[model samples]
Target chain A: MTTIDSPPPPTLRADSLQAIGVEDMGVRYDLRFTKKTTIRRSVGQILGRGSQEPFWALRHVSLRVVHGESLAVIGPNGAGKSTLLQVLAGIIRPSEGAVDVRGHVSGLLTLGAGFDRELSGRDNILLGGAFLGLEDEVTRRLLPSIIEYAELGDFIDAPIKTYSSGMRARLGFAIATSVDPDILLLDEVLATGDANFRAKSKARVIEIVRAAKAVVLVTHDMSWVTEYSNRAVLIEKGRLIMEGDPAEVVALHRQHTDEARAASAAAATAAGLDPGIAGQGRR
Target chain B: MSVTSEVPAAFRNAADDPGAARLIREGLADIVSRRRLVRYLVQADMRKRGADTILGNFWWVLDPLLQMLVYVIFVTIVVSRKTPDYPLFIFAAILPWKWFTTSVVDATSAVASQDRLIKQIQFPKLVLPVATTTAGVVGFAFGLIPLAGLMLFYADRISPFLLLVPLIAVVQYVFTLAFSILLAAGNVFFRDLGNVARHVLRLWWFLSPGLYSLAVLDEVHVVQANPILKVIANANPFAILFEAYRKVIYGAPTSPPGLPDWTSLAVLLLVSVGFLALSTVVFKRLEPSFAKVL
Candidate 1:
């Protein structure tokens, strides 16, 4: 329908996506124990305090993500979903396991990840751009587009601390998308902004992912995963329980969670009815 | 867990942990490329303190000059029985010491203060403290001009040893950088270090030869026996730098008392290099968890 004289719409070129590999990734956090100081305890422990404790946050996870693949990591809170994202982002090393990443990996752990409250919204865009590893000149050249996309007119020059959460989200989302990344990691960022802006942000992600090559989206929203992701990985207690079709994975996760909850409920009911079962509780 | 299945079949597997090596390579490159950010941050910091003031950056010069005036007046009235021009002598020593003390203290807080930036950015963690030190050095250099004028006002002859200021400043800066990194890393784990740092600075100020001459202490062998005081003073980079300042301003005949010429400078240089290296290693090691801890 377009005229010959008019220029054609831009096409997303290939060679943008690349493969990422994770092998037997494990992470452990070591915690030092501090003895509670009581007068009696301190008198007794002129000797010494107790030893520290060690806990595993992630234990022996393995997965392979190929070129142009979308993987959704879904779990309840504190299920090591964000830890896995951070490991992939190269923010932290796995205590054990190997990760091989090809090409640029960009992430949104949360919106306004690098917003300087003292700096203006305009300056934060530059700071965020630099923090994300874009060349200064490239950021300068893209400045106009970033400002426009933020849709945060007039407020751009004001200090960012003055901004509302939605405004901050707009600025963060704009700067993150300004650079085309090979591997995109999103963690609960799309839920921010107003309904109108959220629609725009989702459209932008769809537009970006068409050429994203490899993406890992960590979200609690099963519907969003089933709609957007090609495959899904269900996580529970820091282990990968299932990985396959998004619909099947989401269904499995729900069923599994429900069954565990029901089982716990049934056990509680039985314990309440039986005095013998309740008798062992104090011990 | 076999490597052959994960890596490309065409490429041969090697003994090296390529994942860690790759992280380092990319991380270093990314940090190196963000040099502009360091410049921006430094500029931002300079503006942060002085921008709205009427005097702008002249405050850097004025801030220390005013302190020197107070010290000069107090010492001339109460402490010194000297024929020497006390104001010029104190000004010479005080300027550099102030720079060293303030720079290290500021740089120590630099990394911790930028808790948000540390969480968000992937840039080199060293850049924060380095930028802090750089800002202090720049301000300190500006403060020196006023001190130079005061020296001339007293009709004291400036020595060619003045040329060594740049060289000495670098050594002092390197030492301060090392201390800042260690302190900053410590401060991240325990906020109490910040409060302790203030007390440490106070003790250092009194113990240092900044306010008084080290030459006077020779009369008291008690000072010689107290190696803790002696070591803290003589081993301090500021002590060496301030002694050199005294040498230039007062024309103190011999080199600063306790330190050996080659040995002291060499010790300082080695410590500076070692600290820089240690700070880099420690900062990088601690960096992976900074985001979470913050």
Candidate 2:
């Protein structure tokens, strides 16, 4: 089978160095007991009678990413890293401030997130590509490469539900990276697949970053952050803690983690709990 | 490669935040550009629904045929005996009613059902309900084959008015599309609305002239006494549509107060256009919060 040619270069303005800009962006979600309760509260609120607590997933944060830049976001669990990516992907609307993204944006926030389980993997590639705003002809042209990169072989014709988790990840990664997006948002997508496949996907991710106008990566892998990204930002409790060189940021993140672990261990000892148990509880 | 001096129209300008009009325009443009996505989703939905069945697309036709058979058997054996061409009559009404009811019901959950897509992807959410309605329309078109087979026995009644079937279908399609969009958008916020929709559709079924002819209802004095009920009965698009189907398909006489007048078509046209505009506004307003809610 014939392989697809390289994707055409992105059409961007010569003066446009910024691929993404965030001005004090914030996201707040209302915590509802149930759908009915939410509805009742909404009606009550409209009537000026009810008040509900809202969870602020991310607070005011400002950042700018220029073309050909790979910005790695490092943070602990629930640090609003994914929330920031989601906002940039336009999946989540900010409650305060604004996010401005130029060009065609694609994100691998969740693998096979939109796939229909009953449909064949071949069909899903088409559907997934369409979701990314690729035309049918373009997706069809890229189909052979997607299948080859996924290494599904004959299984490509089978329904996606039959594939293993790793296979699903491979397919998702292949389809998401098929196009040279102007801005790419990745949320730990490269953390899947076997060792060999991981190496292959990591190389592919590097290539995509080179081709993309800008890239935002959220990952816990410190090595990947230090090696692949030029710059990094650390977020804690929904606030931007620091932004600097990837290596420096990684070191700072490690320092913060160690301090947090030590502080928790001391607190656990004071509470008469096992220090080892406290370390596990910190997760 | 050197970047182009002319900025691509697809790019969002960071200088000015997009307002409601720009958002709506962008949403529509996104949907139009991603029409293939809509087609694929509809095909995928149709395939998934029937993937387990050996009959495949045949099931689409069989479902309504089975429904017509049950209604025919019940009406002929249990309800009444004097009604002529009962299967054909019930079927003519049932086809459009099925389209309306199924589309609305399916669309009521369209957005809510695709929680994954809503949460993970950032495309025009309008495509979800629109695609569901289109799938219903496709199924409705398939159901027509069996309707045509039944009409073969009543071939003598066929006339140029049979051409009006497509026109009638377009009217119903618009009505259903508008209604589905509203329900889908509303359900995203108030999921209880979907639960209420099931019962409302059941009540709507009886209110329409699906089982019995409008002529029979006109004979009942109680329906005529109350102005409210009279207006409600007359304003029913299903009743008007079914009556139109019978008039065109069965060559039945246009009985005064029984046959649908121009006012009925006018009402349908107005409702279709009005509801479409209303639903578009509502859907756009509710769209921004869909991901959070989902």
Flag regions of model 2 displaced more than 4 Å.
A1-15, A32-50, A263-283, B1-27, B253-260
lDDT (10s digit) by residue, model 1, range B35-110:
7777777776786666458998898888888988898777777766563666766777777777777777787677
Candidate 2 residues A184-276, lDDT tens each? 899998878899999898888787777887889999999888777878999998999999888889998999999998987777775576666
lDDT of 2 by residue, B262-293 (tens): 57776787888777767777788778778888
**10 residues in a row with least lDDT, candidate 1 chain B:** B1-10
Instruction: Provide the lowest-lDDT 10-residue window in model 1 chain A.
Output: A1-10
Clashes of each: 1, 0
Candidate 1 stretches with Cα past 4 Å from truth are: A1-18, A33-50, A259-283, B1-31, B51-58, B78-83, B116-121, B155-163, B224-232, B253-267
Alpha carbon lDDT at B259, candidate 2? 35
Give candidate 1's TM-score.
0.82
Per-model TM-score, in order, reads 0.82, 0.88
